[model samples]
Target: MIISKPNINKSRINICRENSQSLEDIQNQSSSSQNQTPIIDLTKAPELNYKYGRTSEIATLKQWILENHTRLITIYGLSGIGKTALTLKLISEITTQFDYIIYRSLDNLPKLITVKNELKQFLCQSLSKPLPEILDYFKSSRCLVIMDDLENIFQFGNFAGQYLTEYKDYSKFFQQIANSYHQSCVILISWEKPADIETLQSENQHTKTLHLQGLGEDAKAIFQEKDLKDDEKWEELITLYQGHPGWLNIITLAIKELFNGQVYQCLIDEDEVFLGDIEALLENHLERLSELEYHVINWLAR
Candidate 1:
């Protein structure tokens, strides 16, 4: 379910239908009409099940891609902050404007050469001779390439965005995309902003970053979806969790099972916020922090 703020000048976007055709079907259609069709490869992307309240994010991204022509964009946030969902929603709205829409994931930390070859092969499939470089396709076509789970390339125990020694080449690839003149856009989605993003944004108008945050009142939909009780107390619950869709969804399950769907019961302890199942999610985020960063958080808690 998509929940957007009213009066936002956004085209009506139908959520990805549950029974939509498979990737092979779409690829076949593109093959039949190579010149007119947009080559789409979403084999590695996550299915957007329920997206809540990213209307402004979508509009800003659309403007960057369609108007300002941003070449590189990094969407970063805390774990479970809806980065993937927002991008999926944006793709749904703007897919028709591009000649190609490709989605790749760095979750397994593939090498730079591997990724380059995969993208090159996919983008060059219709050509008589494969292009010498990936940028050639970018120059010849309007493409939207999304690389998700970028944090996988970074060292987990290091400060955020520090690439592992072996994955350092990905930084150069991103630099090339931002510095070179191209009609395509590459969006990187991660839990932490890459180290080069700040420098790139300051130096290049085409390079941009969007730091995603929580959903606000619109997150009430998740609670409603779970059939939680005490409708009037949802605002308090949302505020307590900062309207994080992932965290809210987890908490709703806890309330349903533990408090018999009564939200107030979970909120009764004013001094303590009950994390319930969210503690495990928090642990995953903490595991990625550097020792110093982890200590700083501990100090803050004290």
Candidate 2:
């Protein structure tokens, strides 16, 4: 018996070759042709009861990330000055542009290496991937990583931006994110600029820093929200609280309860704003002051 090879056209031969591939390989090829579903993890984000008045800051942040593809950014401000609120607002606006959005808070003081490993696992499906591989993955997909309360990694009572020794890896991680070729960006929200970040970062390198200030005229919204009376004294009340949303919220509560929502009367009746929980917030800031700062406070007290 003579076995003869069947005639096969080039197109049929190609189809036969494609059919020889394993199911897993075929599945991978099909999946690679399709865009991955975006992974958004914002569980750590804080819920805001009041609408933020950070219009300009939010606009600038959007421009930096979406328009410029800025890789590293720092948003520094006094505690309770609306840094977190502004960041959350910005994230909400730009979430559609990224393939993955992750928000992490350093407030609990997690190790930087631990954070890096977790981020790696989240991005690459395995924490064992090398840094270069992870960065390549970032290049292929847009990721937005937000680290809030970065000051938690710093040592207090020293110069500004001094990272705790154990957390130094964070600086290196940020440097890589800034200098390497990646399509992702990281936003750090802190009380002061991190020391290494301030040293190596430059605006031309897709690295930007924003120093957030009081809301100024925007503070009026807070007053309006609380329905406090005395529209004429709104500026005075805002100035007294230094336009700090946290402080203004505290004062509004006081005026609502003690003066029947009469803001002007509250101001006239009390020479000084009753701090309530604001005192604790101020004390936390005071504890981070340097020796000369303490001396100035002592001299002023005298």
Candidate 3:
């Protein structure tokens, strides 16, 4: 009897598909309770509602997520800089592109959320029908998991500049996930970037870090619609707001008073809090740096 070698490409293809299915099934058996949305659904909260701005950041993130080689990326920036909104927007737009997509906002994670435990919960939920342990699940499946503000859980060391973190334990887990999992991706969104984790990260050619900036023209349109006018006020308002949607929302409230909801109000109301808050806000969020950093930012702003 002649024993013929099996076809090389066909055999390899079958093996790949089988391995993929096995990994995917790990989180398919999720418990009923874990099926519900996490509390940080920014879309529903008034305080967390989506606003126009950060278009470039959203586009960058969406493109990065679609990359076959990129298994992870960070959408990092200062607080109230539209990171969460950009993240949610990207997730909503790209759900169909992934085998599995789950978003867990690390807005207020418990202090006890260790790397292992967090991974376990996510794996459990991702594997809804007969959820298995996280480690075994990632073995074969391709999944997209986003943990917003992961820096909160991580502790910092030498790598962190000002925003030090100690989430080194999570760093190792992420490396393992990326190396072993064939189609797994993770995104960490945070107010401050952690250098410790960045150091421990693999030298992947595909990993990306997107730092968000304020909005441009599109954001002005969003604000204009709210105040109900199309005039020079739109341009003036955009300049004042600097294209941060959250800030624009506050500005919108002020404009409503002057325009009486009849038109866009270019003039700052004498009694308005918006004008008062801008300077202080700039000092608070934008001036956390040393004197040199402040100078640099000011120079760049100008």
Candidate 4:
């Protein structure tokens, strides 16, 4: 499992209160008026420590949301490539622009109806009459809805991005979000892009996809933070692991424990790369591959 250090920062929600009003007066206001404050629900989100890089990626996402007003965005990449961290950082930068910010994980494979109903209820909490359709709420208010871990809804041992039979309705929901007019944005985070997303991108200007890649030199910070020595050898180690943050973190622990934080010792044998506990991380990604994909990988290995 990928583990992130606890984030010391907390999301601050600003409430607009009259400057002339006393604190007591604001507190005494009706509960309905108080509920007008934007709702932020990130309970399901993982705590993110200091993120290493992706300055350009964050800027592109911000442009899509703020300038282009894209309705649907799919951010996909291999696990540990910082998809979630990048998104959380993006949200932090642009939180105040939306009236509601909500996050959900599809790891448990919740049905589309259930997800829609919950979001609608949360978005419509301040209204005396809740909107009949989730899209109605999107039209009426600005929302940033982030759904993570969407790979869970996809079929295992199949072509990447094929949704399971039970979860197929999600494709329709996504299409609606992409095609229909809305003032809101829905971001899908997955290890594999949904098949419909590809089709949507071709036809809709508001729909977009971002394929995240390795951090390159920006990942050197991970080693620096771990206080590993032999700075000259850090680039070789990072390249061997493709600058994957999660894998690099696991390797750092192994280096510190077994090599006494000496980067030179770890790099003594250039012919062999030491995986240590990173084997488990690789297995997690490998186990999700289709038969054809597995065969292709096996052929490449030989």
Candidate 5:
């Protein structure tokens, strides 16, 4: 469970002020002319404390959004790879560009109707209206909607992108958004791609995908944060963990206490590498693996 980092620094506060309006203040406004002001709801988004090693990815995303104004994009990655952090940083910098900005997490297992209704109410558009009528708001306004943790609705113990029957409506909605003309963009962040998304996305269309990978050298900062020693062996440790930020942070505590901050000594002492509640991070994947997949992994382990 990722918690939003509080006590944001002065620079971050200044960023909000620089926009002249903030997502936190959106609820205070009851004015009918909200279309003119940038309205945002980022209450569910985790607060960003630090970001590292995603400069190239951020640049590519900005180019796609600013240069082409792509309508739909998906960001997928393993847990704790900083997908949410990246998106939060991206929006904080560019929040002023859109008239409406909405961020919601699918981790709570929200229903498709509930999501549609929430958008309708926020935009002050009519309920019980046709889908076209509701979507017209996007056609007329520059809205940016981000749905995070989309894999929550997908079935467990299955291949990537298999949605549960109840939540499958989300795929259809996304497909419609990609195919139809709209001035807005909707981004989905998940551990796996949705089955329907691949069918709709094309080179000619304003649809694309970004798959997040572990941080490379920037992972050294996690050790620096923990005050781990043996700077010479940091890369070796990082390579062992595939530069996964969460794994590095967790394993560092054990190394510092058990091996006196000597990363090389820790590596020599423990062959298995990462420890302490690490399996929790892979719970979703574990639950979904097929019998054949389990057999393959078990056979390879021997």
Candidate 6:
């Protein structure tokens, strides 16, 4: 079982750059746009960046990205459903097939305005090119790129960057990035699949979309391997939480400690799941949904 690092300082960030910055790159940005883009300030939430118990989602997306001609593949699901973790796992797993894999989490990028710069920085590292020339040079090469947790560039709140206006949309830049080369893959992981992404699907065979469902039998086994109290109790809990790996991992970890590794007694106590990580994830997507939709998700999960 892998235990991820806890988050340090998170801000309620609204980025003013033309590109989205990764969590690690938070300090590097000049202008913060907290006043713009309504998504709940994820910068202030805890870091929910662990990858756990979503092997099938990772494998399926991996297969489509590697086998299909499409350069950009989007993985969509509800909030806290492990979209980012799936993409992170794929980047680590698929590196062998490509030159190298580069990942950029759209965790804090509230709008499409910041995609170009974020992606450009990511592309340079993944493709091993100069940052200034990444997009132009990507006309030929093989690389796997992932942008996680992206929302609409068109209709959602205030615009943030010049890239939105310059590139028409992030998808077009990504479309070219993925389609320009013969053997390259670009993946987008989002809470909800945007219509622009759906419409931009390749007419012949260039783009693919993978919708992430909750954990299955294999995933359940993985959950058991992690920190949860017992097979039976954890199984019941998953029924309530929809088998989201990240949330379940934290739940299991908390349960394991509460039982002091006794497993059975933790089951007896029937403690509610932990809220820090799940709350952070919810906060990340809170701006994109209504207040009722937001409350019901985490409230019912308990």
The whole-model lDDT of each prediction reads: 0.82, 0.74, 0.53, 0.81, 0.73, 0.53
lDDT of 3 by residue, 1-302 (tens): 12222122211100111222222222222212232221111121112455565666667676665654566677776566687766655655554445445556655644324544655654554345744555465444545677776655543322222332343456655556556545667787876665544654456645667777677687766655674565666766666666666677666765576656532444556344355445666665454455666677789977
Tens-digit lDDT string for candidate 4 (70-185):
99999999888889988877876676577777889998889999999889877886589988998999999989999999999998888899999999999999999999998999
**Candidate 1 has what TM-score?**
0.88
Question: What lDDT, from 0 to 1, does candidate 6 have?
Answer: 0.53
Candidate 4 ranges with C-alpha deviation above 4 Å: 1-37
Which stretches of candidate 6 lie above 4 Å from their native place? Answer: 1-55, 108-136, 152-168, 175-182, 202-204, 219-230, 254-287, 290-302
- What lDDT does model 5 reach? 0.73
> Model 2 segments beyond 4 Å from truth?
1-36, 125-133, 269-273, 300-302
Candidate 2 residue-wise lDDT, 1-302, digit = tens: 12121222210001111122221232233234344344555556665544757788888999899889999999998898888878766755655566667778998999876787777766764235555555776787788889999999898887788889898888877888888888999999999888887666653468889999888888998878889898999998888888888888888888898889998787785656667788999889889878988788889967
Off by over 4 Å in 5: 1-36, 125-132
Supply the global lDDT for candidate 4: 0.81
Best by TM-score: 1
Which model, 3 or 5, shows the larger TM-score?
Answer: 5
lDDT by residue (1-302, candidate 5, tens digit) is 32232223211111122222333332233122333356666766665554467888888888888788888899998887788878877776666567677788988899999998888776553235544454787887778899999989998777778889898888778877877888888889998878777867753368889988888999898888778888999999988888887677778887888888888787775647556666787665666666777677779968
Clashes of 5: 1
Residues forming the 10-long window of minimal summed lDDT in candidate 2: 10-19
Tell me the lDDT of candidate 3: 0.53
Once fitted onto the true fold, the runs of candidate 3 whose alpha carbons sit more than 4 angstroms away are: 1-48, 51-59, 109-115, 125-136, 151-166, 175-181, 196-202, 228-230, 258-302
